[model samples]
Target: MHHARSLTALLLTVLTLLAASACASTTPGTGSVPAASEDGAFPVTMTHRFGTTTIEARPQRVVTVGFNDQDFALAVGVEPVGVREFLGYPAPDRPWAPEGVRGKQLPTVGSQDLDLEAIAKLEPDLILGINSYIDDEAYGLLSGIAPTVAQTADYPEGATPWDKQTEQTGQALGRSEQATKIIAETRAAFDAAIAEHPEFEGKRAVFLLGSSAAGFYNLGADDYRTGWLTELGFDVDAKGGEISYEKLDTLDRDVLLGEGIAEADFKRDLVQQLTVVKEGRYVGLGAFDDDFAAALGFNSPLSLPFLLDIAVPRLAAATDGDPATTPAPYLG
Candidate 1:
């Protein structure tokens, strides 16, 4: 009996030891050791107009004073802790912001003016901006908060193509490869759409925006929005013609006018003056559901994909016969 009791006690001790060993071997929450890449030095260096910026390890927290920068960061799979307030013109809602970032919960730092004090409160490891809005004075202020980058292209400070801007910003965030992939994928998607709808080939189109004060600005060939249109194989209007703030007597060739204008007035004044308008070739594009026109003004990384999606269908409709059904022939 004594021998049997001693044996049972030994068995219980062995079982306890085994259970404790198993529990230790299995990680508590994740079930595996944390990856080296997840918790190691991932240094990246970026050159911008403000100068060289080096970030050690991936930034866990980010802030953006510009919409485009915020968009790029989201595309590369990072959500900014803070971003500029959703300006009203680009869709009453921020359709382009990441699914998780919406409503008043994300915190807004006022407009593009960049609320430095508000941003400082967030304690972000990185901050990003673009175009003339981020001047040397702003840069000094932003850098004091965190690493900041600005647009570097020579083509009028604010007019860099979306793809180029994305590539540059992605590099700064240590996600150049991912950026390249996104761009290539987006281009491929566009090319496929163009292929599916051959009517988009060689179609002439225009982008028009009207201000409450400044009549209307006709987007020229050099404009970033035009570059997007041209990518889908549209023949963009020449910027050589002067933009008139005064009421126009005529609308001309292959005009793609903005919505909100009285169609009858446009027909009588602007439409009758242009030869194309007389021929009934004018196409009127309304405010896109995505607020693409307003988004373009901000020119952020978040807006590029939205721009492509919006332009593709609109261009297809303007050039193609039945936007809902049959594809139309090219209108060059």
Candidate 2:
């Protein structure tokens, strides 16, 4: 009986030690681990434009306030308890990235008008706003609610590069390996497309957006959408602003792309008669869903691969210099 009691005590001690080991996480960031991320890698520290944020322990409940941050988290198996919506844009994750939000209908937090109370109600342990355009005042409020990670001051306020944004989200979640894999895959796709289309090299390309009411605007090389064209080896030097209807001729380049521009609007501005359009080098951005547009804007790991499939073929057709080929037949 005494021998049996001794075995029981030994088993209990082993179990106790195992339990203690399981919970000893929250290590400081030393960059010692590989991109796959090390177990117990937190508390991870990331410095953005606003300041530095260190996530203590792996998060259970996260809230993504950044417009496209959700997609990054979703790409690496972290779904937020709440997500920011963009003016009726279908949860970008649903179509572009379904793995993270698969069958999980996440709550809409807020857009430009952040709902601090709603976010707090979600009880998020981590608040990711890397693309949220969060100001100092807003950052204070969010950090008050939970540890908030804002966009890198490295790029324009709202325009963090997709790869860096992915890595940032990964580090915050303690899953850098998954982030590295996705980034590598996406970059490989771009490289493959570039190799296939040497003609795309050194060509001038710019993406413009316009409506009959809003006129037209240009996205320069620095813009995320235009940056994709730059990745494909286009010489994009757009100044990144409005392109008046009268000055439409200024956008004349090797390849011209636009979103929401109607054939009537082009005809009204006599843009259809431009050399770019006349030579079949102009490509309208997407189909009715504007998935292509969302992919261009989100420009996240999930969307870029999706974007490549839609963009490469249309760009190839448009840049082939065959006016007979239609880049977007549905648009016409």
Give the Cα lDDT of each candidate: 0.57, 0.75
Q: Residue-wise lDDT of candidate 1 within 237-312, one digit each (tens)? A: 6662445535443324343645334445454444456554454444454443336555555455466566556555
Task: Give me the candidate number with maximum lDDT.
Answer: 2
Taking all chains together, the TM-score of candidate 2 against the true structure is 0.84
RMSD versus native structure for model 1: 17.2
Best by TM-score: 2
Least well predicted 10-residue stretch by lDDT in candidate 2: 1-10
Question: Can you give the lDDT of residue 150 in candidate 2?
Answer: 86
Where in model 2 is the C-alpha error above 4 Å? 1-38, 287-289, 330-332
